[model samples]
Target: MSRAPGQFTVVAPGRVNLIGEHTDYNDGFVLPQAIERGLRIAVCRRPGSRALLASDRGGPPLDIDLGAPLLAGRTDWGRYVAGVVAGFQRLGWTIPGFEARITADLPSGGGLSSSAALEVGIATVVETLAGQALDPVAKALLCQHAEHEFAGVPCGIMDQFAVTLARRDHALFIDCRSREVAHVPLGTEVAVLVIDSGVKHALGDGGYAARRRDCETAARLLGRKALRDVSSIEWPSLEHRLREQEGRRARHVITENDRVLAFKAAAEAGDWPAAGRLMRASHASLRDDFEVSCRELDLICDAVGRLDGVFGCRMTGGGFGGCAVALVDGPRASSIEALARTACAAALGHAPEVFLTTGVPGARVE
Candidate 1:
C-alpha cells in the first residue's frame, strides 16, 4: 500500500469506571481502568497552511482555519478534535498543521470515554506532527481543556486521566482535588462486562447541568467547598442546616462519598461481594436522589443484581441514558453477558452493544 510520508500513527485508550459516580467533580476519588477500546489517529503533513481532519466514519476532513481563534463554539462533533488543537496552541505546546484521520472501536455515547479517546488520539498525533512530547498530566489537562473550554462539556478529569495515564491491568484511583494518581492492581482473574443500554445521553440533557448546580448549592448550604470536602460524620449537622432543595443533594453526596471509599477498599481487598453491593447502593442513590439513572439503566442494574457470578453492576456514564458496568467471574462471563442482553431486550425492546475489554495504556504516537 502506498503511504503518505510523515504519517504518524497514534493510539488513545478508553476507560471503564469501576466505582465512583458523579464523584470526580466533587474532588472525590474515582477508580477507573483504561480498557482496550479506543481511538486511533493518523496524521501527515499537508502542503498548504490549512489543516484537514477526517474520521474513519467516511467523511471529509474538517478544514480548520488555523489563523482563527479556534475558541469559537462548534455545533458539529468535530469541535472536540479541533478543540484539542486550540488547547495545545493556548498552552504554548508547539504544534503544526497536518492532515489527520481518526478510527475507533470505542462506542460513542456509551459512557466509555469515547470523546476522551478521540481527543487524546488527536492530541498525540498533533504533538507528534509538531515534534513535541508531553508529560502524562499535561496530556490529560490538554484533552480536558478541549472538552470543557472548547467542546462545552463540564466534565471532570477521570476520563482524560484514565485514558492518558492509567496503568495496564489496573484501575487508577484519582484524588480529583489534589490531582494525585494511584495505580491499583485490577486482578485479571475477574472480568469487566460493559453492557450498553443503547440509550443516548447528551451531557446537558435531562437537567444534568442543573443537578450539578444543585450539588454545588448543597455544598454551600453546609459551608463546604465541594461535595468531596464534606464527610459522613458531619452529615447530621449539615443535613439539618440544609432545606428541601439542599438536604437531599447533601444526603446523596455524603453517602455516595462513603460508598466510593468503601468500594475502593473492597476492590483493593478483592472482596467482590462487597464491591457488588456497593455498586447496587450507588445506583440506587443516583436513581432515587441524584436522578441520573433511567428505566433502561435501572433495568440492567436490576437484571445484573439477580445474577450469581455478577459481583457488581451500575450505570457507568453521565446518566439520563447510557451503559452500565458489571463485574463478573471469568468462568461465567459469557452467560452473564447473554442474560444481560436478553434482559435488556425484554426490558427496552432492543438488544444492546456490550464490551468486555482488557485494561490498556494511554495514547502513544508510533
Candidate 2:
C-alpha cells in the first residue's frame, strides 16, 4: 500500500469574479464562482516539530520553524505558504511537522485566485490533520490571513472566501464586509469560457497596491469606510465632492456595484443578455477607470466582443493582462475558442489557454 502516514488531501478550487472587480478590497459585494481548475495539496503529519512546504513547480520547497516569525522565503510564494502555518498558530493549534505537496491547474497570473487556492488548500489539510474542521466562513478568514500576513498584500476576503464557501454549479453572492453568502444557480444553456493570456499578476506589484490606496483615498474623501457604504442614490452627489481624486477610479467601483445588483436579478430571471451586457460594461469600467486591463486584456476582450455568438466578454481578475471571461451559446463556443486562440496569437504572439468552467465544491479529497 502507498504510505498513508496519517495523510490527507485537500483540493480548493480557483475563483473567477463574474462581475465584481476591485470592489472587493473596498468591502464591496462580489459574485465569484469556484471553477474547475484549482490547487491540490497532499498534507501528512510527521513526528518532527518542523513544517515542510514543497511544490513541484520547478521551485524550492520551504522548510520553516513553526513557532517563529514568518519571514521572507527563498521564493515569493513561500510567504503564502508560511502565512498558512502562522495562521494556524494564531488559532492555538499545536502544529507538529507536516509535509505538503502542492499543485494547481490554474495559471499563476491568470487572475483566477491561485494564491488563494494555495492558502485554503493548506488550511484544509492542516485542519484535517489536527482533527478539526473549519466552518467555511472560518476557512475563508484563515486563507485571508495568509494573504494579508504572509503574502503581505492588503486583499479583500472575496477570492479566498468565495472559493472556500461556494457550491459547485452555483455562484456565490458575497457581501464583502458581512461575509454573508447566497448560492445562485448558473445558467445551464449558456457556458462560461476563461481565456488566459499567460500573463502573470503579483498584487504586491505596485499596480495592485496603488489601487488599494485609491480605494482608501475614495473612502476618506467620501467620509465612509468603503465604497460599499455609499448609498446607491447618494453616490453621484458624493462624487461631486471629491474633485481632487480621479473620476475613473471612483466611477468603476460605484458602477460595478450597480452592475452586481443588476446581474443578480438578471441571473435569477434567466436573463443571460442582461448579465452578459453588464459584464461588458464592467470590463469597460475596469479599462477606462481602474486602468488595470493591459493591451493583451483589451485585445482578447475586443476580439470576443465582435463574435456573434458570444453574449459578452470582459477581463477578469485584477486586470493587467490576466484572463477574460466569455459567455457563449452552446452551439457556437467551439468556433469562438478557435478565433480567440488565433486572435490572441496574432495580436500578442501567444496562444491563449481557454477553460470551460463550472463551479465545484469548496474542499475535497482526491
| The best candidate in terms of lDDT | 2
The digit string of per-residue lDDT tens for model 1 on 1-366 reads: 556678767889888788887888877888888888788777778665567877876555698865556774786767887788888777666556677777888777888888888888877776677777788898888888888876678888889998888778888888889999888877855788888888778884536677778888888776789988788887776677777866776677678778877877887898888988898888888888788888989988887768778888899877877789988887778877888777767777778787677678778765
lDDT of each: 0.80, 0.81
Candidate 2 lDDT (Cα, whole model)? 0.81
lDDT of 2 at 238: 73
Candidate 2 minimal-lDDT segment of 10 residues? 67-76
TM-score of each: 0.93, 0.94
Clashing pairs in 1: none
User: What TM-score would you give candidate 1 relative to the actual structure?
Assistant: 0.93
Q: What's the true lDDT of residue 107 in model 2?
A: 90
CA lDDT, candidate 1, residue 58: 59
- For model 2, name the residue pairs that clash: 292-320
Local error of candidate 1 at residue 41 (angstroms): 1.4
Q: Per-residue lDDT of 106-138 in model 2, one digit per residue for the tens?
A: 798789988888888877777777778777788
